[model samples]
Target: MSIPKTMKALVAYSATEYKYEPDYPTPQCGPDDIIIKTEGCGVCAGDLKCQHGAAMFWGDETQPSWVEPPFIPGHEFVGIIAEIGENVTGYKIGERVAADQIVPCGECRFCKDGHYWMCQPHQIFGFFSGLNGGMAEYVRLPKKAVIHKVPLEMPLNDGLLIEPYACSKHCVDRAKIEVEDIVVISGAGTLGLGMVTYAKLRSPKKLIVLDMMDERLEKAKEFGADLVWNPSKVNVTEEIMKLTDGYGCDVYIEATGHPSSVVQGMQMIRKLGRFVEFSVFGEPTTLDWSIIGDRKELDVLGSHLSPYCYPFVIENIANKTLKTNGIVSKSFAIEDWESAFDAATGKYRDFKVAIKF
Candidate 1:
């Protein structure tokens, strides 16, 4: 297969500034790098949030900007290894592969301590200029990249979900659900549904999912959610309390970027319950801190990008243990990225949307 010198890509110049380039430079593999010919890349909520100038990505009064523009915008991607550097080993051309979203600096304190996902510089693909992402014809995986071989039998769309599913698995791991525990997962989008699948495997007493969309709620049931609720239709907190005999759920995982889900989780979780937050919010969420420390004494944990879970996710997805049906609701050719982004941003209320390269 011949590699093109240039390819189409969606480039980000700044917050709210993006353009599609038909002849962007194609990535070239370095001495210890691998170049992937993109198969598909999922559109993440974070990407949409960043496009709209989310404070988390564009920087606010409290924190510096995380995204350095003039880069492509995609992290959930899978592809074929089109090129491998001379020094690269254990990989062959034409094999399917996926890399972790974050490219850790390795020398940072967090990376040295084995928490590479929290590398101090925090350069995530698709966001940092130096680390271009898969929203292009080819993506370069540097030497430090944590790479995994995706099984050849997995569908491209399913492979595209590996990144988000890995993050969801990490969130479920943080919940530390017990067999008798009643777990509640907020939001029925891609990450939320993935949580439902993994949480079910934990054999929780009851796994509940909350979302406003009826279609998503229905899909959550198929993904092994014991109960699906629409906060708009019923009193979710009251209902949860009734189900738990006024004690509230044992674990709450928040996957909705909306602030209301955070408040709802706090109100419906048991006093010492595990609360795992794993969403990228477009705006600041205001909440009382007393409930966490003084009142409930909850164990609040924040889940970042997937850490050391990609292989598990890949294996499960390939074996059919992790249900991925209907999660990838739509796919668009790279030329039609605007429509894809629109569908992902709720124009079609899609569960997940992808850009097929």
Candidate 2:
């Protein structure tokens, strides 16, 4: 496929406004960079939070803006390599690939210590670090970008989910579910369902899923959740305690990014249990400190983005180990990004929404 001189892309000018630029310049590959022809880009919750004018994304008085606008806004994406840089090795043009959402500065203290995920100067794709995102017809992966070769035969639609699934795998690993443990995952959204999938692989005695939406709970059940609960309809804390013989669940994972879920996890997790917090909440959540340190003595773990799990995510999706059918509810062309954004943030709870190039 021939590369174009200019391409259409959604250029976010501010937290609330985005302009569709028909003449957006297609990226040129640097000596160590690679250019990918965008085929699919998932609208992440981070994108939605920024679009909704979250102060955490846009700056307030105390904090600087995390997601500066005036750049393309997509990170969870997959595509065919259109060009490879001269100094770039280990990859070739025409290969399918997914770049890690983050591009670490590599000179930071964390990078030097091999914890690149905590790199001081973090430049995430689509979040305004001068590197444009995959919402366009083409996107450039910088030299510092971590790239994973995706199997060409993997379902094109599911390809966009590679990032989230990897993140889920990492979160479940943090939970460290024991064979006879009772695990509860709060929220049955994409990542929550992913936890259900990966946690089931551990052969935990019971895997319970809690979501406010009945539809999402049903999907969790289909994803091999031993039990699904609609927290809106039941006193989920009491229900979990009863199911676990008043000991509470052995592990609780909070994935809804809701403040209430944090409190719920604290209440439902047993003494000495593991609590994994994986969501990026829109607001701050206050919880009792004693619950974590004194009363329960729970082992609290925080899960950030996918680290060192991309290969497993790729192989699982390619091998059909992860279910993909009905996951991406719909796909829209670049020209129809308005509809795509609408679907992503709409009342309809889609497992995933993609902008197809």
Cα lDDT tens digits, model 1, 38-140, are 9999999888888888787889898888888799999999999999999999999999999999988999899999999999988888998879988899999
Best by lDDT: 1
TM-score of 1: 0.97
What candidate 1 gets wrong by more than 4 Å, as runs, is 60-63
User: Which residue window of length 10 is worst by lDDT in model 2?
Assistant: 342-351
- Candidates in order, TM-scores: namely 0.97, 0.97
C-alpha-based local distance difference test score of model 2? 0.88
* Over 4 Å off, model 2: none
Query: What would the per-residue lDDT of candidate 2 be over residues 321-355, giving only the tens digit for each residue?
Result: 87656778888988888888888873677878999
Candidate 1 residue-wise lDDT at 68: 80
What lDDT score goes with residue 355 in model 2? 92
Any residue pairs clashing in model 1, and if so which? none
| Native-referenced Cα lDDT, model 1 | 0.91
Task: Please give the CA lDDT of all the candidate structures.
Answer: 0.91, 0.88
